[model samples]
Target: MSNTEIEDRQFITIAIKNGLVSKEKVDRAYILQRRIYTQAKVHKPICDILIQMGIITEAQKAQLNAARNVLMGKREEPADEVADDALPDINTARELELTISKDGLQAFIHPEHHQVQDVRIEDLRLFLNRRRIKFGVVDDGQIKSYLSQSPLPEKSFLIAVGQEPESPTPPELKFYFDTNPLRIGRVNEDGSIDWKDRGKLPQVNAGDLIAEIIPGNPGKPGKNVTGKTIVPPKLPKIRLKRGKGVDRSEDGHRFVARTGGMPQLIRKNRVQILSTLNIDGDIGLETGHVEFDGHIEVNGIVQAGYRVKGASIRAKELYNAEFEISGDIISLGGIYRAKIQSNGNLRASHIHTSDLTIFGDVVVEKEIFESTIETNGQLVIDNGTIISSKISAKKGIYANDIGTEASKKCDLDVGIDHRLEREVNLLKADIEKNGKLVQLRKADIEKARQRSDYLNTQLGEIAQEQDGYMVKQRDMDAKLSEAEADKDELQIAFYQKTIRELGEKRNEIDAIVEKYLEEDEGILANIPVYERDVAETEGHIEAAEQKIKALEIESEADPGHPEIKISGTIFNGTCVTSPKATLTTREDYTHTSMRETDVEDGVTTKKFRIKTTSL
Candidate 1:
């Protein structure tokens, strides 16, 4: 190539490396220069084309030319020796394009299209230094080998590589128990769930290891192509807070269980062991019939077809399940078709077709439908209906409504002790039996009196016969002394013996009559005693009825009144009952209250009345 051509190429390479102009724009300028030269047989410099095309300004061109002169070691020649457009070249080294990556990690050198001597390693180093790539330069031997090729390689050559920054390792928490223990069961190949294999319950025994902390390292620094330090990010420290029933190791690196119970991870970093089994999800077949000795908390629903037993229970909803809880139960969502027996109070949103026997008070927010509920304390439905259900409360029952127009009949009984009522019924039966016994004793006294009268008449007949026999015996005795024949004397002796036997018979009949009189008196006396017993039992029954009435009156005046208070409509087919009376609705009544009150119908009687009032 001519000296002018080489100088122009050197200026283009320097302009591109300095970011004054892009390689693509310079290439286009070169194409235009070549086309003009071919069409008009004229030589146009690439620098002038680039300037005319607005790719580079004249000032930028001049600057690039100065830098090129310095890089190529071109000394200024005399004006007499060099033409105005021609450049004086003192060296014949090939020019190269240096490019550094955006990350400052790697650099490449592109060989230009020139047939000249190989580039010096010192010049290559100087070129990289100008681009701020002072680190990780290639060895001199490698650069010589790259330059000694038969034809200089046209592709880019990797001249330098920078060190990558090392990142710090993050702190790790390694739990012995499963962190996400409350999960659904595994799925089989046929898309069916293996409910028996519901994920592990993170249970731990006393002194068992629960978790451990793994320390992290602060990573080493790295150097970039500019020889600047790249510091790694700091490792985050993890802290574990010990909760109830949890013990930490002396070094604070290990967490252990202090009691035999389930382990739970709470608030992101706390490790706790709880006596209560905390189920984070639903109680379904996947959880497979929970039976816990302590309290149970279900975050989701207690699904259908599950049996759960616990000391206490708290759930979002209960659906077609059976629960036997010794303590109180709280269900946020409604209960449907569930059978629950709680010794303690029950609080729920609603109850539908469920059977509940609560010893303590029951509070339901919404409606209750087709359920059988018996409570010793009270049943309260604050804002909803008690439709198609049977409710019996010892203290009282309160609800917005008793039944619905389309629902089945609802039966409610309040202000009475069910046990005491049963006892009264038994006493009434006993009273009936006692009255029968009194009648039977009166009949026995009459029979005994008849027997005594018959015996006395028989004694009278025997005495009359004895008197005649005595007269005959006296006549026989007077004749015996005057008799001479043996036959007459024997006859008189026989008659006297007969008279004595008649007297003995009269005495026996008299003794039998006396015994009958005593037996009649005994029967009559027993009749009075039986009658007294019947009277005492009747008195007891009356007393019990009075006590029940008094209790009903007291319950009506109780703070939690033993009555049905309906804020909304109470429909037909609803019956409110007490121990003594019942009130069945015949039509819908709005904002009514039902309670047992005493009414005088000839005698004082307790009756159930529905009074319309604002609730």
Candidate 2:
């Protein structure tokens, strides 16, 4: 990063020593001059010496732009796409122990890159910045020196969060209120967003799961703030406990979000099974049954013929308990006795339930049944068979014996039957797809069509108004023009400007009307002017388009678009779910959509649903 020049006693003295300045050495020297030193430091004689040696080329200047752009994260230029095969062989990166110039601290390579060049710690840190990764730290030379000399040894880095304070701490979590603007409720404050806090609370059954946010970072993207988000089965008057802690994520009270916020906290607005307060003999719990509500703990062996329901319904030593839940069914005892059908997490021990359907993660101790062994979540089979099923998740499936080929996208363990490998490799394909996405002009077409209708009506109203105004102005004009001298102060500026703007609008509207006539008159020309038919009209929609663009340019200093602004980014308590429409009021680049304006300023994020394709 430095640009300094050495006093060139070498160039003159070296030539004196050799009794001549050879072109090759001079060429190399010029390359060093332009690259390493500024023009002022590198004198005219030395610079000319290198250029005269033919070291600098027009091609090198172009290459510098490509090099600088690639470093700055821009698209590569066409010629720069040349393969590295033409370049010199330079792979074998070696580990180099180097001491810092300031502290003389020898920096050791904890994990060496297998390439040829020594990876400077600074370079490694820069590479990590390109990819925003957490859970890593860059300590100064002092820490590195300490680690090198420490008795514990082999420790590359260490970060320690300080202990909790003696005084009570503030809550780091909040539950979102699903209002037009999201109703943010502090987990620790008075919970009255829900009407239940006003005394008329909603009915809560035994199985209903209630939850609140615990300890976690809560930044919502580009915003300069962070807060933990939590939820419950129903949108209750949320009650978040103060400070950082974990509670009630057991039985059916686990912290998780089925959607929104992060995957942290419990499933919002979904039934969760709570813990069992009683485990008795009279409870006829059996296998093949599932619970979405409160805890179920029974003493007897679950009869294979029956099923039970609730949150955390369990049979003590009961193997063969047929437990079925749409989301998660966690069993502490045996299924040897029963088969469990779960759409979510399934945890059981020494059970003989072969049928396991996990739409989520499944960790089991025994053989799985012919339940298609499918899991949209992770699957962990410790002791038994995970037969014929497609496992699909963003994460991996760890197991001992997987009976069949993976039929879908799955991060499977090392061992699998190679015979059906192709079928097992039905991994989800990541395709970056983009087409014309319906013509961009459809927006213009629709806009033009609507404007035509509006303009026609407005023209009629204005015609009457203008005629009346003209009559009144004629009386005034007659009075002024009759007087002749007072005509200059007649204030025609307002009327002139209005007339000019109206004429421009008339041109826009007339062009669209002609386009509609020109396109459709050959076929079904009789279509009504419904204002919506502009997209279907065939004429020079492009001309109408250029006028709109001109207006947009004029709008730059003209108060921009006429839309009222919402203060925050989130709409209706959710960060916009409609992908194309990134409407937000969030200050962090999330612009809240203005319902008042027909088209947003940034872009008409909504797609143009074209009615016709030919033109």
Candidate 3:
């Protein structure tokens, strides 16, 4: 029987046997009896005595312990509600938007929406760039919007925010992680599929047994570090036991304390709370998650589970704390005690302050701690020293000076410091020392503008003085125009006269030749030989004409349609063609650039070309 059932049966039997308790009272007294029954130190005889004494009931203790067990973190909790899915399930995958801003990147994290999370400032919140987003830090808020509001710290520790969105999938749903069979052999234990070993296909026992992870928990081995809690009331000694008489007697000194008394008496430094906070988990004294908005500056050590997001954050101390961040971060300290992380610019002075893992660009005025920095822009250092901070930038990193190890992609850059120095100088020269320069510039601009009016007056005086010259220039231009027109007319007329003269000369020569032919003398005798040659050419032409006629008759003709003319031509080791349809033949034509192809494996090179043809 269940513990409750056994306790219930015991309570009923005791009441009935005693013959003093009424049935209604026995029912009500079940809970008090159960507590006495379960108290290991107390005897079963004592429990029966308690039931006989009408002190407690079985059901009430069961209910009480059940609540205590849950509070103690000993019981498995019912399913917790996962965060709500916030990403819209819009049908269209791609969308675009545009807006204008006077403030460029300072006020805006990204120029375009997609590029926001990809954007990062140098050296402040280090780990907030394109590569390697701060893990365990994704939330429902739009990542792009976060960076626009602030710039990362120049040399600061990094922090990340946690607030994972709700699960979109329903209960009983399955998910898969690795599908690479070569690297990690596939296992089909998801909810949709049956549990099957590699290359084997039958189902396993029940769905619950099909989980892929091996069965083991730190319940007995590794420190849970979860269930322990500091007393909820900061000074529980003063608060919880105040009215309940003097709580403790530590040698005439009464102090409010737990049921077991103060930890000081036990000599345990870490104050432990017997009570539970949300299932009685461990109080987060050394290492745990941190979430904040405005600004976080830590003077003490941060051990681990270090996630911080805010408009700005400054950590004086860090030791082995993982960080995810959305905004700016700065740290005066080092990370030898912990690993520092940031989404935005991360700048820290010494190794102890910022041994960093940066997602954004790193701009360290001083030495970079032994850490990995990945950024989208430039890795900059104001000082020429880096103690093994591995850096990578998507766009090439520009360091003012290249260190010996700069060739190794992961090594830090010495050149980054020079650029940083120039930046500092520029800032100083551009603002602090530019007052006199600004006044000078304004005076120069005014003088130049006044010179324009002065030049206009001088131009008028010069124009009057050069009036005669201007008249001469106008006459010369007119003469030049007239001469050009006359030359064109004369050239046309000369061409016509030449043609007429040549015609007359040809007629006179023909007449003389005819006279010579009639006299049967000299050149006229050779003319008959030329006539014979022409007759032979005519005979060849007649033969070609007959062959062409026969071919034309054999060829299929389409009427009232575009004509296809065949002419044989070779160009660039291949055939030349005008625009022609399939099966149409083509030949000799002046090969224009468009008509010629460099014939590669008999494939036609296709390209569009523009050419001007005269009408």
Supply candidate 3's per-residue lDDT for 499.
47
Q: Rank the candidates by lDDT, best first.
A: 1, 2, 3
Residue 101 lDDT (model 2): 20
* 209-296 per-residue lDDT for model 2 (tens digits): 2354444323222211011122212222223331112224553224333322111112222333233335555335323344434335
Ranking by TM-score: 1, 2, 3
Alpha carbon lDDT at 430, candidate 1: 61
Q: Which pairs of residues have clashing backbones in candidate 1? A: 396-562
Q: Mark the regions of model 3 whose C-alpha exceeds 4 Å error after superposition.
A: 1-288, 304-311, 337-341, 351-360, 395-615
TM-score of decoy 3: 0.20
TM-score of each: 0.34, 0.27, 0.20
Higher TM-score: candidate 1 or 3? 1
lDDT, candidates in the order shown: 0.71, 0.37, 0.35
Q: After superposition, how far is residue 490 of candidate 3 from its true place, in Å?
A: 99
**Candidate 1: tens digits of C-alpha lDDT, residues 1-615:** 988789788878766655557878887888898899899988887788988998776655665565576676674333343332222221222366667888778888776665535566555565565556778888888988987874567788888888887888986888888754432234468644343453545578999999898888878888777788877787777778887788888889888889998776653467777578789999986799999876698999999999999766778899998999865677777899999987667777789889998766787777888899988777867566787789998778766777766778888887666644565566657666765665675666566567757756776776687677667667756665555355566766776676577568667756766776677567566756756665675676566567667555544444334477766787886777776567787878777777665643456655445343455
Error of 3 at 222 (Å): 76
- Evaluate residue 579 in candidate 2 and report its C-alpha lDDT on the 0 to 100 scale: 11
